[model samples]
Structure formats: C-alpha cells, structure tokens
Target: MALYGLGMAKGLLLTFSYLFRKPFTTQYPEKRLTMSPRFRGNTFVWYEERCTGCASCAKACPLGIIRIVTHPRPRADVGNDYNVDVFDIDTGRCMFCALCVEACPYDALHMGGEFERASYRREDLVITLDQLRALPKKPQTQFRPHLETAGYKGDTELDEHDAGRWSL
Candidate 1:
C-alpha cells in the first residue's frame, strides 16, 4: 500500500511540475529556429555557367539519382561547350553525402541548408535546373566559394582536359 501511494505521489508531482513551466514549443513559420552550421539539410547546388557538361556529377552519384543530358555546341564556338538540355536530381534517393559537389571540377555544386523538404508525391521531389537555380543564395555565414562561382559570366567554355583533374 505504501509503494502504491508513493507511485501515485510521484505521478502527481510530475503532472504539477508542468503547471508553471514555460512551454518549449515555438510558433513555427513565423518564429523559426536557426539551424546549426553543420546541419545537413536538403541538397542543392548552383548551375553555374562553368558547368562543362562533363557529367562528372552524374558519375559521382552512387545512387544514380543524378541525370544529365547535354548537346554539342556549334563548331564555330572557340571553347568546348554543351547545352544542358536535361538536369534532374531525384531527392528521394539522395544520401546528401555531397560527393557530387566535390566531384565537380568547376565547383558548380554545394550543399544548401533548407531542411523543410516535405513532399506529397515522389515526382515533386525530383528537382529541376530551374527549381535549384531559383533558390536564394545562402547568407555569408553558410557561403562556400564553390557555390558562389555559379553566377553567369557571359559566354564561356570549359577546358575538357581539366574536367578530370579534380580529386573527389
């Protein structure tokens, strides 16, 4: 009987403990919590004009989630160039290891820190070039030089010989 009474008292104390305790939940959307610097959220990258269509990213992806299609530039073009006709990344299968980003010789890809990746359908998770490009550049605190170099710099060509030179 004493043990039963003691258990009841403990339960009641725990219940009362919360009566004056401040609520830990914050109003989401309006009040967001800052993520830590090392947080690995959604994987995103810049489609910098420097992407040589070398297909290094596609090859580096272990899950084969990255798909890229390129077309030949006109022979009159001075430097090697290809039109990126298709670039798709299935976020559903991505492990976010950032191997693709590191494999890029032109430093075209980088990890972005946006964690709200909820989706209702699988197709919605497949990000396209336009969608990835539309993401706002992260603040300086999270900035990486590899990502900043994605801006358009007029017509330029990638040196084919240098594509395979980068170490992953």
Candidate 2:
C-alpha cells in the first residue's frame, strides 16, 4: 500500500515545478525572430544584373504568378542577354514553394527574408520590376545550396558577380 499515493505525489511535484516559472511571451514588433538560411519569405530578390531573360523562373511557377517581358538584344553584349522590359510577380497568390528560385539557371533570383508585408489592398502587393529593382537585395538562400555552402547567412545583401564565374 506504500505505492498507492506515490503516483499522486509525483504528479503534484511535476505541477509545482512549473507553477513558479514565468510564462513565455514573444515581444512582437520589437524583437522578431531571424529566419533560417532556407526560409522563403514574402518577397522575391531578383537580380536584374544577372538575369539572362530566359523566363525559366516564370515557367517553373506552378501558380503562374510570375510575368516577364524581354526584348531580344543578342547583338549587344551587356548586363543581360535580353532587355527585360517588364517583370511582375504577384505576391498575393504566391504559395512560397521556392520552385522558381531553383529553376533559375543564372542564380539571378532568390527569396527575400522580410516578412512584414501585410497590406490593405491586393494590388499593393504586386511586385513590379521597379519595386523589385528598389527592394533590398537580401537573398534568403532557400533552395540555393551553393550560397549556403558558401556560408551565406542571408543577413546581408547580394550584389553583382557575387556568385563568381562558376559559383562555389
């Protein structure tokens, strides 16, 4: 009969152990959690300097939310192989699958890390070429293993020729 009250005593001890501990609460807006290297945030980081106008990213999108317009400029050897006239990404319907980033052969596209993209209207969420050009170049390295292997922590911006000639 000595073991009769043993179960109850153990349960009581477990409850009391947590009774004096402080409750856990997140300090939202002030202290945000930094996403991991492979997080595909609500934004897209498109490098116009590296895009070859191949439209592979758009083709890879299962939701068909990516749009691109490019003029053939084969004669001129410059920033990109074609003159990208329009680039539009509808963020309102994106599923964050990261497939587009993987389809990019030139490594010109990467997922952004900022998640404060709450908007009042859907139209306001559409990422145009101009906005993409202006947004901070913070690649989250979602599916790009080379960047991760290169030790890109997604804390900084990626600039021109950052991938090097052959990538690491």
Which stretches in model 1 have alpha-carbon errors above 4 Å? 72-79, 115-119, 139-168
lDDT of 2 by residue, 1-168 (tens): 678799889989999988788857669989777679788778888888888889999999999999999997756545436889999999999999989988998888888887788999998888999988988888887777778888889889878567423642
The sequence of per-residue lDDT tens digits that candidate 1 reaches over residues 62-110 is 9999999999886565665787888888988889887887787665665
Q: Give the TM-scores of the predictions, in the order they appear.
A: 0.65, 0.83
lDDT of 1 at 140: 20
Q: What is the Cα-based lDDT of residue 14 in candidate 1?
A: 99
The true-versus-predicted C-alpha distance at residue 57 of model 2, in Å, is: 0.6
Best by lDDT: 2
